[model samples]
Target chain A: MTADTTYKVPTMAEMAANGEEPEVLFWVGCAGSFDDRYKKVTVAFVKILNQVGVKFAVLGTEESCTGDPARRAGNEFLFQMQAVGNIQVLNGYGVKKIVTACPHCFNTLKNEYPELGGQYEVIHHSQFLQQLIDAGKITLKGGGTFKGRRITFHDSCYLGRANKVYEAPREVLQTLDADLVEMKRCRTKGLCCGAGGAQYFKEPEPGRKDINVERTEEALATGADTIAVACPFCMTMMTDGVKNKDREDSVKVYDLAELVAQAYSL
Target chain B: MVFFEQILFVLALAAAGWFLTRRIGLIRRAILLGRPEDRSDHPGERLNIMLRVAFGQKKMMTKPLVGLMHFVIYLGFIIINIEVLEIILDGIFGTHRLFAPYLGGVYPFIINTFEILALGVLLVCVGFLARRYVAKVARFQPERHREMGRWPRTDATLILVFEILLMTAFLTWNASDSLLRERGFGHYGELRGTVGSFVVSRFIEPLLSGLGDPGLVAVERFTWWFHILGILGFAVYLTYSKHLHIGLAFPNTYYSDLRPKGQIKNMPEITKEVQLALGIPGADPTEPPAEPGRFGAKDVRDLSWKNLMDAYSCTECGRCTAACPANLTGKKLSPRKIMMDTRDRLEDLQRGWQKTGPDFDDGKSLLGDYITAEEINACTTCQACVQECPVNINPLDIIQQLRRYRIMEEAQAPGSWNAMFSNIENNMAPWKFSPSDRFNWADQLKQ
Candidate 1:
């Protein structure tokens, strides 16, 4: 299993090998840059795209914050500035469509930027990954009947609620064949991990429940030995929540990238 | 003389009523709980908001029953103040029988009923206080020191002591009135006839017999004033205190927003043609019909008069942030902050207007220096905060206004933003896949 998975948007053939840059650009969001390892998944993402033969290009570090923080802070000016700047970069690249490993970035770029004049065809990496899986380009290693354990999945607010992305991850998990139990508060009503909205930077305070930890407790109640995460943001927060609950030995956090990459095990 | 008492009571109440109504109106407006605009835009949202936002309830069928129960008890407060109007009239005049006729002839029953209810509510409040202070439920952190969690013990003591004082006043009024009516001046003798009669027959009767004194009549006369005076003091104490809402809630609820759901009122539109003809702030000020770019709620005076009313009408319920998906998700955007900002701005304007100096035009606009772009974009536009707001102030309107100023007027949107906006502006779609591609995913015959 690859320890470092960079869940980039484009396949290596499109990014490096193929030399055929499509109209679409992949936005590797900030959190994905810092924590998402198992870069093999990006390779897998590339593998799926190559098999499916979709046209796309990779844009790393070229994209920045979609000014989500600024918008929440009541500073539309800075958000607009961010939106305009990002649009210029994307337009300069002659990019028309995009995909991403990060849901938050995808949500902002896809849903909000049009208001500021930056609009592109944006989608989550899970969509492409699922498409590749459906085509039988590559079968998942963890696919089919993982026993001796029960696991729950935490659907991120951004992916689940904001972007309405629920099916792709669940489908990925079902392929793993692990015993999947749902967190009571899953899907649209899924609680937050107290890490979004740039809250990871601030100190935890009273009355502010750690949505991740609270969610973790719910997962733990299901007697799950592992918690699968779809979004990289959910990955990092859930990792900490598992540790905080001292369930490191009992329960564990797995990035969908890492989990999917495991399916490629020889 | 008897008619003078009733008329004097009525006039004094009328005066208090004016200021009271004004306060209620201002708060309701500021909270933005006005009736719906189109009335049909969002039925589901309206239902959920009414159930969750207004009642501080949630869809428990989806969430955990435990959490749901906690919130209900946390939110469902039964306010028992049947003596509200009577209390006010009693304060206005030096009368103790305030609305005594309306309640049955049982004085002890009336006093004991509210006293019991207040105690029960206090018990519930204590549980909430304990949950906040002791158990430290997630999302219970107090943003300010003077808030509930700061000095939990002291705050609890103060509230409990204050409630005790109210109960104590009733107790004293009952005891003293009983003594005076035994000497025969009280109109209602419910409590006095029971407890006081017993005490008077045993203790007071024997004492009077021993004195054989006509001066005992003077003592009873003094006792009657003390009974009326005690209730009067409670009245004045309540009106000037936080407990004032005990008298204000019904009026506040009645004047609440009864409009159609989810529709924000389109702000005042001025004759834009004149402003287009001759630009002042460089464009048509839409409300005043000036230049096009003249926005940011215009002058401090341009702020909705309803917003001004919110400050006085604030119930200090923190439900706005509680239901705020952003706040719960860890964003710094406090729905309460906007309300507080409006209040601070109004305070500043009030002081500035009083100044015998130059009228400041560019200190801090709500859409300008005070708030930032980061805060605005972070919002998921979930409307949880808006729905959760008991008073119904629309922060979304303010956010959209700020967004309008930034994108349309300032021309400061980012690169990705322009990529997104230009695509939509030119193609009328979020993506550049072309209009025909929309049908590529659609198959009419498949259904």
Candidate 2:
């Protein structure tokens, strides 16, 4: 087993060289790769995995867009072109049992990839984390930073409604001993963060209110200091929403993975 | 004199047939303008869907009270139309109550049943009129619903009033004919003393008792003519009104996308292109097109026949808009409006083609003039609209196509979207970083 003290994370290429197959393929999605804020969530998730000693490896440079944004943006040609390349690589690797930090990635890899013959048991990171906690592999230190704080989760449309993963994130949050509150429009009725359907990469068409702003208003109305999220896209939108309300100083946004990492003190 | 009556009846019949055939032909031609699609697979599933959704009114029953009210009118309309068959025979043969002699014991039962249904249809229509004007159902109200403008609202009211008038005419005809039979007047008395009597028509007989035998005959003839003419007119008017759902619900439900609501259809042309690019040897090679077509749909002709059919099938019910997250959150998108816009654009194209031959262009397409970029962009693709549409209209399909055209064909995407596209093309992701550094987030995973 790789030691937690080492800085090097295992790559699928290295695993192939060592004649080893990981128990799970950690698909560190695009946001995990480059977005500064989401990268922290990625790190937190990795740390929890390391503490649990679950064998996992990433594609590193071999990873590409799942083509979700392209498809959603109406670029079917570009999306298919991208999807074909990724499917070829994943199939070549003989990878299975994939876990992803991004719900968009989880959705595409699980739901869309099967059409292209790239099938795997795909799980969102919150689900994988919940599984580890359920199996007693992840043990959190008592009286963590979020022990008694009010935390309201903002459901990612892809995660909650698209995939029906409402319980996993809440289960992970429960480990931090936080007082979890509910938004008026939670679970299936959850609103979008104004960043879905490639909206993250575009200026919103002129409207009375951006969806994220309205969603954040609901999150704030719950009077929760910490707004929890499961998807990186939700993290970005909710952070922006909190900031738009000028509550970044008081009402902080966090991913469930980030809270897990903090609780484990890894 | 009998010969002249038969001649007049034959001429009226010919005129109604001509008008009905002409209207049906126009609709068929207009729908055929849409590109061909193969929705013929899964015949069993399609038939099941047609029976449940259209015949059984399953989707309509999601809202119980409204569904029951709608079912009453729908059932009444169909059942009462059985009387129209006999009227047609009478008109052609110059025989009063043509089927009564042949039906014998069953004739009165059928007539009594028709009388009851006619009353039901009339009462339901009045209730609907009150709901639209007095009770003001939010879906029908004009202020909040952008598509429920003057003509659409008036069209709904007009259909209701027309039904009421037709029912009145039928009841008047039956009551007058019954009175003439009691007075032993000519052919009317030949069908007298039929076993099952008209309960509702007997009550209405007093209202027409003052008309003498000659006057009663005139009244019966006028109403009989009016009833048949009104039925013919309604059949033609449906092609213009949102009431086209009355006819289209069967085919619309049959052709509904049977896949999971969240699953978007793959573009076949794009799939082939991708397979060819990846050096997959099995891709059937075909002659490259002389010129590439537009990336996505820009007008009604570019949409699939199913989509065009969906446009024709819309009930303007606003269930889709009510469930739309975008509309709920104050965005410009309204799924009902999307369908309305598609149908309007289709009609405009058909009208233009009719006037100027096949090579016609109004220069006003579905994208800019009818449905705006703001509305299309506002969609979150949540499938809530798709889930709520009673007839399985997929407005999201049209929205996606329009967005695709804006991005790929016109290159009119927002500046930030351009950045995302560039990022994906270069870095294989939507970020401004190299792929090698993707694992750096794992660095802090160590103690």
Candidate 3:
């Protein structure tokens, strides 16, 4: 459950150097790499993969942006310029399956990459974790850490509407034995945290209120102690909303992987 | 006196033809003002899409009640136009019920069928009018949507009211002519078959019964003139109204994006540039080292012809905005507004060209003057708008084009976006960090 000197994590480059291939490539997205908060989610997911003995390797230095922001921001040229580079890297490695915690990356890789001839079995972490749970490869101890806790899962736009992975996150939540309350707008009709379409990087246009603030108010209305998220963007936006509402101390935002990790005390 | 009537009919026909042709020509020119795109591939798929979405009304069927009403209106519009053709021929030749003699018994049947359709059209138009004004369907009211305000509401109401008047005129013409026949007036008796089973006219017979031959003739002539002129006027006015969708739906559905809704198109030009930069094998070389051109669309000219076609094809139904998650979440973005803004800007551009030639620089564009960065940015790119569009119009395409112009051309993206852009350019990711540290998250699993 903790980092030790003798433990080793392999990179795709290192695995290829040793004439080997992992079962899947763990795409540590930008936030997973550098964002302090999302890094914990990334580490938790990695620990689960390690515990389940799923052989996964990081692309490390070879990995690049999927160009989701570039494309969404309307810089198709930059996006393609970025996508083509990443596609070359993935194709060069003959990567067959990819797992990522970010829905944006999952969407771009699963949907957009195929057009540029970089096709692979791309699965979101929530879905992959569900698969692990289904296969009985990972088990929760007793009722799990979220047992009887009032938790509301926020549907990330990319994961929910863009990709239609509504059930997987909910299924993962079900395994926690938590009181999974839902906001008024959930699933297909879920309100966005106003972070999609590269909006996270921009100040909102002169609207009466920010979209995240509106969405956060809805999540808070659920009266759930925990606001569970599956995407880093949603996490950041929801966390900010909670702080703005002065409910940061009362309502905590945890990535799905964070809950799963906490259940195992990893 | 007969000769004068004949000349007036001829002149009216000529005027209608001239104006309709001019309006259509303007639309063609405006559509062509956009950059060329090759949507010529997949003939079979395009045809199938046209038949299913536009002709079959597949998308509209999702809301069965509204869908049924729309189907009735659509069917009436198409089937009733047959009578318009008959009117056109009769108007030109100055013949009374010209088609009636050609097919003796079938003439009555045809008229009866036309009457039924005209009645349907009337009812449906009334229902739509009530939905807009009486019940005030939230989507139809301009007050609920700033983009749709007064002019759009008036435009919609005017068209519906126009249809009601046109149908009334036709039915009145029928009733008065039948009355003339009953009175044994000149040529009215011998001109048409039976006139026996006039469904709508039979009910209207009481109103026209009091008018003698001269009075009947006057009523017939007035209704006749109003009906024909209304048809002509409607045709001309459609080019300026959301009703242009009647003419545009077929082509818009045909050219609609057949790709999976989830797939965002990649720029092939940029792909080639990146390939050469990455030193990929067999990549095209000596193609003039890629210099960045306009990164995204700035004006109507920068958008593809299909996008411009979509603008023209928009029905202003607000279905897209109604389904939009951004709009539902109270964001400023509305897919309907995007199409409206695009169409309005394109019209402005067309007018500018007409006034000052193609080289005229009004210094305004589809981006800032019409659509704003805030609206475009608020989109979740959920494709709810695209999915809900009955005619297959894609507002996301326009939004993306405008966003591209903002980021790539104007460099007007927010500071945080600029930082992310720099991060991607330098570190090959959206985070400002070294690639060597990417696997550090996995190190936490060490035991």
Candidate 4:
């Protein structure tokens, strides 16, 4: 799908200035905000949201990290600092519903934030897409670009085992009319992308192989032409893994949102 | 002679009961050493979970073959213990087959069922032993898993061998007693009549047929004593061995965390500090602020009681370690080892307390002395280990707590992590990007 240059994204600050409140606040996580590769995913998601006419506004510059990495790395001090800051911003807007494309952000905002007095009805993008599709708002083109293609969904640890949101992403994938295959370890037994617990920031402890490499091998073993992911961390790790095996030419990694956008020609 | 035998049986039973209770009490005390946690909520849900996971062995069924075999052994062990009740009554009253007269024809049917289960237990124990020693399963191998060192490996082997021996004695006692009934020798001949031979043990009868009536009585008496005494000894030994899971698994599964696995527990203490720092205003002015305790777990005592109970409940089955992404990738962090170390540290503290009262300091801690920073840091917080555990034990909670201690208390996080921490502190993200530019990605869409 070609990039839509005329799409104007609204920020929470701008919306509030107009005495407006969106149906849901889009939490653009650190990766979705700044990572070069993940920027495309953000655009694709925005395209889909705009096409569906969902009233969603971004926190924009007001958003901060959900402190998942800090908390997982055992720095509760830094974690609460970032968490409380974001919670205040979210509360200031009186955001009652939130949607994010990142599992780490989704997990923190949905589960961890409530205990810190930042309760919001949070849903991941995959679940949001599934909801849209279920509500007949997202009708795909029959036998579209991804029809009958082999697509394997890598279960992000935060999304699958951690939060038990296994079926929603796969439910979203089912709409593509694609052959959804599974890795040997999928769903509850899914392997990590080797980027959790702040492992993304540092070298892995000496091991026989990196966890992402091992997980990538599992995905490659499935022989799927396209790898579908819902989390940005999995996007980076699995993309690196596809590159490590030099299979970038033969295989492609796309976020669930990106796949939907491409299939819809949004 | 029967009176003397009854007295000996009573003495053995009393000693066994005393020691088992004492050991169990010690274990209870050790588990209680950990900090308080309110897992008491959701009683009805906890009971359902306990029933499904522990009683139903639901998670174990994920691996059908192993699960079926384990189910056989578990069912057999429980059913066979019913026969122990009969043995106890017969011992105390100096009666043979005490239930035989009360139940009439149904007694033989019950004995046959016990015999069949005993045979099943015997065979499954042998199969487990072979799986551990002969086939050398990867999870059970000391060579592959350092935590399966001499003591742990031997403890597993000993339990299996003990079960096999107990089953052997049970079957032999039944076989010889049935033979003696046929011969009309002593109590077996006088009291029991010709209540038909048990189904499984009848096959064993021919082997003891060559031993005459006197030899038959000797075999019957010897196996009867051996079977009951072995059961008594095993009951006492159970608290000291990894086999304690047979009992603790129920309570462990019952009190497990019901929250989403992604939710790392909120530190209210840290929250208060952060709220105060940010001037968020929730602290009560009327009450003097309590002194802040340790940030995270440095010792077993700092861990929640559920964590310590989880350690005691671990079967050391290595399912957690086997499924761990970090462990599979050859990292030093084995979820099973984390549990084992917590248990070992608790036991060490328990030993010290016993020697010099409860205040005794062992000068050892669970964090540094047993588990290393390298091990705790390797965890991906993936929850694979948590998912794989059949009894609902969570190794990730302990790993995170130890990681918290290392980073928050000792300030010993890795160099790159420190950099990431500072970056998040200043930039509101883990990277050194300006928060004002968080929406800069939108510029691409406007092109």
Candidate 5:
């Protein structure tokens, strides 16, 4: 479904040229920008922002990777090179707040950037969505699509144990009125989807089973038909995991943004 | 003569003290061999964390049953050691139950509580041994964790067996002492008779009932000697065993990383180089750059002091390895093994330093010789291991440093990683997509 012609995504450059400033700069991370599946999440999050009448601008082409993968993979030189470049562009825009759908970017920008003179009030979109919901700015229909449906959220390590945003996403999901079944391992004990630490870039070292597959088994054991994820990396891993188990037809993996967008019919 | 006995006790005390002090000094030196980073900030917060995690055994309670058993042993071990104070004073001053006159009613109560805790410690130690050997808990199994090889396995069993023997000696001594007191044998009868039979040890009194008054006195004295000597021996052996956690856990938890688990420490040295290359406004173009230090940890010495301390603090519980996503999926990396290898390499260096000099090189390093590239690569940096550790050890820090070393210094990263790195460098993303087309996903909105 295409949006009306009135809907236009404002770029930071365009906003600067027009002498306008949005409330928050939406950081469409590498996956949110380039990954075909994760692009939908970016679109869904944008739709939610528009529906809620929240003024937001995207960096578009000016935004670069936050160097999370490089730093995690131990290429500190390359990581810092990317970090400084991104920070300069961010500082150039005078961006004061950032919200992102990617946990990796959220973590790096919120925690790692301040040390190198790049600091802002950065937050994961899950936390942002929870705030909106709590503020009563966004409301779901009485009989939303996810009502009573079994949904198990796969905790993103960067967001959960890393930053302790375990409840924000779950709280957002609770607004859908869906049955949130918990995996045996949840919260601090939650299993990784195996794509973290740049493991997504390379094949896993030979092992009996993939880490994502093991995590998927736990998710499936909860018997939830819908698996929810907060991070783009977890989305790729868990989606691939479902396809690997030949349960793609039965189980669907959706980002929290996508679920919220769909639930509200944005 | 009592004089000779006193002299012997003093000699044993001096020897134990000397050996423990020497070993502790060596450990401190070895840990200091690592590069320094300040973990001394927020003393109040660190104290709170140490109190909760180490003293309160907070994280261990994640597995309630096992945590309770561990709490029993820990509480029993600490409380029962109070009795040793009396033993030591009695040994040096040639006094039998010296506190009995002053303590009066409280003496029997304290002894009764000690007896109960002693029984708890004995039972829990046996249960722990059974969990390791009989039930074959997955975490403790050498078959599951190759790092639990013969010596590590033997080290654990040896401590358990040692504690069991010590507790047995204590109870048998108490039982025999009560019997001798009833017979008013020599010095045993000198007490105000206020310290009655201990609660739990009374059960053992039946076995010693068949002995004569002289035999009972000898049994009491021998077991007393055995119990005290065993404790002194255990203290020295602690420095050499994984049981060092009994002492190191306090400091390790106190200095734990207080930042978010996901926040990997940034390298200021690297940041300077990056700033200079980018010609950032604040970077001094005319000034000469600082000499480059090693990028990451190539050996134990290259790691931080906290990382080295984590190795010594590790109890070899295998909880980290058990929680590791890589190890759970059969990958080669085990967080427990990483800590074990670090400690082993440090010890190797310590021995070499003692034999030759501080500058002596062994032609081996922790990265290549102990922990292999494959093991560190398999880590997902999930922080599950760090979260699972009861003592707040961060194995992820060491793994990340080693990864940094492998990639930056050795340039030994796998082909795909190199490709990804180059892609991120040229394309501004991990994949080979053009940055110009970043907004393509938004085209649908305009349509």
Candidate 6:
């Protein structure tokens, strides 16, 4: 668990050898591996993929960081190392494509990695689920046919700004029978969920606006009953923000995967 | 009285001629302003206030000592021109003799005082040049990523020579006038004799008398014509050259905005008809009448005259260049080049536009290739360029507009964007996660 002198982030070669190919190389990312709450979603998502006969695999445990942090700090050299290392690992495993539940991993792999020669079929979990739905995949059983369960979506900056991925999640909301409300700064100008640039693991700048709380307040102002998020980072930050506002009972957070699971009565 | 009157008439005619030419071109350049509408989501109703920053040097003043130094030298050149007029009048009216052709007067002392001020101004210019070339403040360095080349060093050099010469002439005239005051009639002053006093101590008494010939008057007259005319000519040339920063200071300062820092402007749609009507769309900085105006800057001509003028006003200071994150992070984007590109292409555009009719546009296409989505998207929107811009041209707004055009209109984007966008519509997150248990974290976090 600790980075030793011999610390090496997991390699795709080792992942392939261990038969960790889980259809989508669902990169749990660093925060997922470290946070107990995030680890549960990854576990549950994996279990569902298994139940549905969706073949998949795990990656090298060394998938610790995406180096998005270093790049933003003007340290391009470190960014390149992480980029090359990950690409090499993925290439060694013959990973022609990857599916990630982490928005940071999704953005990094989908947008940034190509600069360092890492190119592949990459998808965020929401898009993958939507594809599965379109293919007449397992239909989720609606619990109480939860209609009018108004939920506002938080756009992670990387998912929105870095890649401009805006609408797929909304389509998921449409299918799940959840009423969708959008924040004022949705889509390309979408506000950050306050957990990016590897900020998921560190304290933000003091005296700076907490974008997550600001976004959560914006969502709350819309009178939405619940907040749905596709990224675990958004889920964590939104959950905390909701609690801090004492809106725990009035509003709540949900992961897209967990929502899909409940609808299918998994 | 008749002779004095004739001299005043001649001087008035020349000054009027120079003033007229200066006014026309500067007015035309300023009036032919363009504001490109490519990058923003502006409210379109708020004050531009950006102008205040450009004219105020407020942002530059953040680096206070450096800002104050440029301000002093900039204002000094402006004030000395009044003194220059006094010299020209003195020449024309034939007080033509400095210190009145009669020696030992209070007039010589006043003449000597102005010379000292000119020297003081010249020293300030020296300091600014050193800060840019030698001290190499990050703000003053080229914002090159791999260092393909450097900024044009010529602009700095010319301004220096121009100031030094003016100072030299003033000192020469002063020293010569002083000695002539000490000697007696027929002793005329020029630059060499002004400084020649220093050498006068070493020279024989014969040399001082030798310097007093009518030839010394010719010497004074010759250096006076060249130095004064040279500075004046440089002033006129700067109105059209990259050294236009000289002309840019006051107007640029007067128009600068003092509003919120780097605030985003909300944009409105510009209609196609407006382009046809105005002959260019998306270039007006002010609001269009209630109608769909230009959606975005269709070409460079569609830029506002202010935006176009912003190009000429640059001193090639490299402040914006040093601050661009994309440039720093090794992306092919430099804010400085964007401004420089604006100025460089103007001539070619003018050549083409002039030869053609009113719709005579050289096409804003030059910037099209240079400010591509790749370069635009690479920017982190960090406001470094905005913060570092010596004249406060917000490259961030331009980059964003270019990006919007690339995304919304051209549909040109990176391959990964397709997958990312699909996920947003499909899974409600960029990640294709299952929707059934999005809240499962609630149960697991009990520990």
Best prediction by lDDT: 5
Clashes of each: 98, 0, 1, 0, 0, 88
Q: lDDT per residue, candidate 1, B101-159, as tens digits?
A: 45545754655555455445445556656666677654445653223344433443455
Q: Give lDDT tens digits, candidate 1, residues A52-166.
A: 5566655544445566544443344445555666666676665778887776677777777664456688878777567667988657655344645577888776677566678
Residue-pair clashes, model 4 = 0
Tens-digit lDDT track for model 2 on A1-266?
A: 34446534688999999999999998988998888998888777777777778899889889998888888888887788888889888888899889999988898888888887788999999899889989989876657787779999988878876777889999988888889999987776677787888878877766677778888999999999999998888888888888999999999998888888767665
How would you encode candidate 5's per-residue C-alpha lDDT over B8-36 as one tens digit per residue?
99999999999999999999999998898
Q: Looking at model 1, how many pairs of residues clash?
A: 98
Say which prediction, candidate 1 or candidate 2, comes out ahead on lDDT. Answer: 2
| Order of candidate numbers by lDDT, starting with the best | 5, 4, 3, 2, 6, 1
The model with the greater lDDT, 3 or 6, is: 3
Which parts of model 5 have CA positions greater than 4 angstroms off?
A1-6
Supply the TM-score for candidate 2.
0.84
Worst 10 residues of 4 chain A by lDDT: A1-10
Write out fnat for all predictions, comma-separated.
Answer: 0.01, 0.56, 0.62, 0.92, 0.85, 0.00
Residues forming the 10-long window of minimal summed lDDT in candidate 5 chain B: B189-198
Off by over 4 Å in 1: A1-101, A109-145, A149-155, A160-227, A233-253, A257-266, B1-8, B21-48, B56-116, B125-164, B167-186, B189-342, B351-447
Best by DockQ: 4
Query: Chain B in candidate 6 has what TM-score?
Result: 0.71
Question: Clashes in model 2: which pairs?
Answer: none
TM-score, cand. 4 vs. native: 0.98
Ranking by DockQ: 4, 5, 3, 2, 1, 6
* TM-score against native, each model: 0.52, 0.84, 0.86, 0.98, 0.99, 0.52
The lDDT values for all models are: 0.52, 0.83, 0.84, 0.91, 0.92, 0.57
lDDT of 4 by residue, B45-80 (tens): 999999999999999999998899999989987888
